[model samples]
Target: MSIPPGESAPNVSTGELNARYDKFVVDLLGVIAYGELSAFERLSSDARYSPTLHDRAALGRMAVTEFEHFDVVRARLAEMNMDVELAMRPFQPSIDSFHDRTRPADWYESLMKAYVVDAISGDFYRAISEFLDQKTREVINAVQTNDESGALLQDRLKKMLADDPRLASRLALWGRRLVGEALTQAQRVGTEHSFLRGLMIEDELPAARNEVSTLLAQLTKNHSRRMSQLGLTA
Candidate 1:
């Protein structure tokens, strides 16, 4: 249950709020660390599908960077006195299921998955970072701000689409499907984790609902913009 609106809710103490915030930070870090680890694995696997040696090497580099990001978050979790693996375990199923359902069929689809799907997740993390403490916020900002992979993916995808305009329709459909699966994965995570849910809501039901709606809208808009960047319809 959520915190009820106005007088209907019990008064919450400073201690309670601090504890809640601490749990939220730990939960957030855990999920991010797991996500990076998963990305590293996926990108490493995806590299084998690369058409050229240069592309394979580029993906290998990106995968290494992903592992580096995972280590950063893992260290933060350690500092919080949290068991890193235990903290990340709860999120594994939902994230794994998302990837299983949306596994790409080819190199082009893989590129779209890497670019569109990962960017939306990054956007979500950036949005949530607004509500976290300074140190936690800094950690998230540092890891999420990686531009080399994004730039590389964008350049390659744009050129691919330009070279074969016929691919646009298929890739656009793939992008839409990926976003749908991603949202389902996110919903499952939020439902299972009350502390994460608490971070997204307010003390009032209506306001909280509105906040969530606004956040989804913003995410969708950003996704559409990303699709347009690749010359695809969202």
Candidate 2:
């Protein structure tokens, strides 16, 4: 991926990379790719709940965009001689569990779930990218790039809450539930994957617990902004 000169990442010494750091990169990329693929599937399936043909088509397009991101991450992994599927395999259970536990009950619920999850993922990726080489960090940021999907969802949700004032409370609770479930799954992933869990400790970035707290704090702030955009309480 040839980024524009203006979009280039900070220069980092390639010599800083070692076998362990390489494993970390491969594993991180694999999980991110798998998450994108899973998001594509979920969004496509959830499109069934769209009330109008246009909405359905729009959601389908969003799903396609997610799959495109998955392809990008997969290509990056392959360039490093890692099998994409193998890289993603370790994260499957945690990701699946998160989705299973947070199944949406309606079109609005699905939209909110997508919004909340994507916001959290974006925050997490931005913070975690610091542990990566410049090129790898750029790849991760590319996958997290926002498009019209967020704006579309935000508009629809704000209108929905306006139409039904009671929805604000329910959806706010739903948002909190989604965050709780997401954090739970994240903790599980860290516990199960030693390399992933040790990314901070081994790299001597900072205390892992403190770093996680900071990540959550950032996610909370972003989540509140998204909720406010949707005319809901945080």
**Model 2, residue pairs in steric clash:** none
Alpha-carbon lDDT, every model: 0.81, 0.79
Give me the displacement of residue 105 in model 1, in angstroms. 0.4
Q: What is the lDDT of residue 208 in candidate 2?
A: 67
Off by over 4 Å in 1: 1-10, 195-197, 200-202
Show the lowest summed lDDT stretch of 10 residues, model 1: 1-10
**TM-score, candidate number 1:** 0.91
RMSD of each: 3.5, 5.5
Instruction: For candidate 2, write residues 1-234 as lDDT tens digits.
Output: 112222323352333334446777787788789889999999999999898998899889989989999999989988898899899998998898789889999988998998889878877877888765789888988888486777887887888888888888889999999988876666677657643442433344446666677777777888888777776678
- The C-alpha TM-scores of every prediction are 0.91, 0.87
Per-candidate clashes, comma-separated: 0, 0
